[model samples]
Target: MHPALSIIVFTTLSGLGYGLATALGTGLLDPAATATKAAHLLALALIAAGLMSSTLHLGNPQRAWRAFSQWRSSWLSREGVMAVLTFLPLAASAFLAIFESRYEPALGLAGAALSLVTVYCTAMIYASLKSVQTWHTPLTPLCYLLFALAGGFSLSTFFAAMGGGNLLLSSGLAAFFVCLAWIAKLVWRNRMNTLRPISTPETATGLGFIGKVRLFERPHINDNYLTNEMGFRVARKHAVKLAALSFGLGGIVPVALLLGLLALGAAHPAVAVGVALLAVLSHITGMLVERWLFFAEARHAVMNYYGG
Candidate 1:
């Protein structure tokens, strides 16, 4: 709930990487193009870098190696494993695209699938945590998937615009998908706002006498790890303002620019590349705020004891 910068970087960077891989698989990147492959590989490198940096947030870097051992029950482990495995096919495809021609498409397709799986695993890491009612929903996974797609589409628009020619088509597609994702995001936000907390103080404390329990004493004078991690609370009005800013800057502005690019028949490289850069930057930043509020706004049963 405190919103680790490492995590923010990790998610946004990984989103970009995964999105690129998806575009490659979907033929949006045109793997036959040498420039496209080069750009994609570069993006993948950025993703790997972000993920590695995120690992530092863990208490024990050495013990992080043990994470891969529990893929059976842990979404985090699955995410790590899948994240690493995805690189193999992606690198291989990039290599083949550069050196050999025959097997590139097949390898690219495999990389794309692996990338999607990695993203899904990451999504489940949050969605599966039942203690967090706001995150534990079917919509969570869908949101992650859509975000990945939207982000990927945004990247493809830039890459294509830069290397090939006009980005009008890709920008149009990005705008369309972004709008759709925004709608879904709104639905999710509304659902979360209206949803009741999964537990109450009495249930957690096992004290059956409950008409309403208000905080009678301080849990601690100073914040402990749990309080720091889970006790984050934001004003409703402030959250609404932030959400509006995120939606407008991240969603609406980019789409409007893209549509304008199309209408004006703007220069190929500038229009496409500009939109892509702005969209990814805005969206990723917005996602950071969103993820932060997501954890912060959640009402834990313990909070009721704190008179939340």
Candidate 2:
């Protein structure tokens, strides 16, 4: 459950890239506009950066390609395959939008669908682990999808404002998605707060009927891989502060800014774009903190054996 920087960057960057692609694919932005070309290029850049970051987390980066062959039985493999597959349509859509200045509806839609499915596969890689009760809920995928949409829409608002396109619509949609993502996140957190631990030392040892089980000695004289990886702990007080920070910066601030921009109604394009850019920055920063917490707060079932 240790929070690896590589994976954190991968999820956040890739989610944003795919979300932006989805917005473009769904016709939220005009394909013929110069801004659309910039957006397409930006999306590809984010996706490529994220994909590269993931390889750094592997034991053997050169051998990572072998992961693609396990798609039938592994969510990780499915994610790997889907991530590669998604590039086809996304690249095609980008080419047409950039060079031809034309939006092929079918290709765009296909790319969007594949992008979302790849995100789903990423979520499932964590959610399917029965040992991690916190991530085993349906809310995991929902959170991932909603956050992607929220981040994507926020970025789109910035592009629209800068491009002098439909600022009102883009900002409005961004605000709505931000609110929804925060609500869903609050619900998920509340559930985790109240849910009983499904695995305890006594339960793990199948000796609950005898008496309370307690650790009498260290598993080893020193820390091992399992302890370092699965036995991560965070202070409850720190978690509370971080959660507040995440909600305020990622959700509430973006909503307020976008709504304020919408209310101003036809403000100078430069001012609107500036505010949109601020919102995008705040949201991405908040998401990074939230993702850090996501990994840090998890308690692996294997930890029960080690007196976690």
Each candidate structure's TM-score, on Cα atoms with residue i matched to residue i, is 0.90, 0.97
Q: What lDDT tens digits, residue by residue, belong to model 1 across residues 1-308? A: 55677876787778778877777665565555665767667667867877897797998898888898999999999998898898888877667655663236677778888888888898898889887787888888777777777777777777776663336666677777778778878888999889977687767666658565546776778778877766777535488887887787768876776676567564555655676677767777776676666655665655665655
> In candidate 2, how many Å is residue 203 off?
1.3
Model 1 ranges off by over 4 Å? 32-35, 98-103, 208-210, 234-237, 264-268
The pairs that clash in candidate 1 are none
TM-score, model 2 to reference: 0.97
Name the 10 consecutive residues with the lowest summed lDDT in model 2. Answer: 228-237
What would the per-residue lDDT of candidate 2 be over residues 280-300, giving only the tens digit for each residue?
999999999899888888888
After superposition, candidate 2 runs with Cα above 4 Å error: 235-237
lDDT of all predictions: 0.73, 0.89
TM-score of 1: 0.90
RMSD of each: 2.4, 1.2
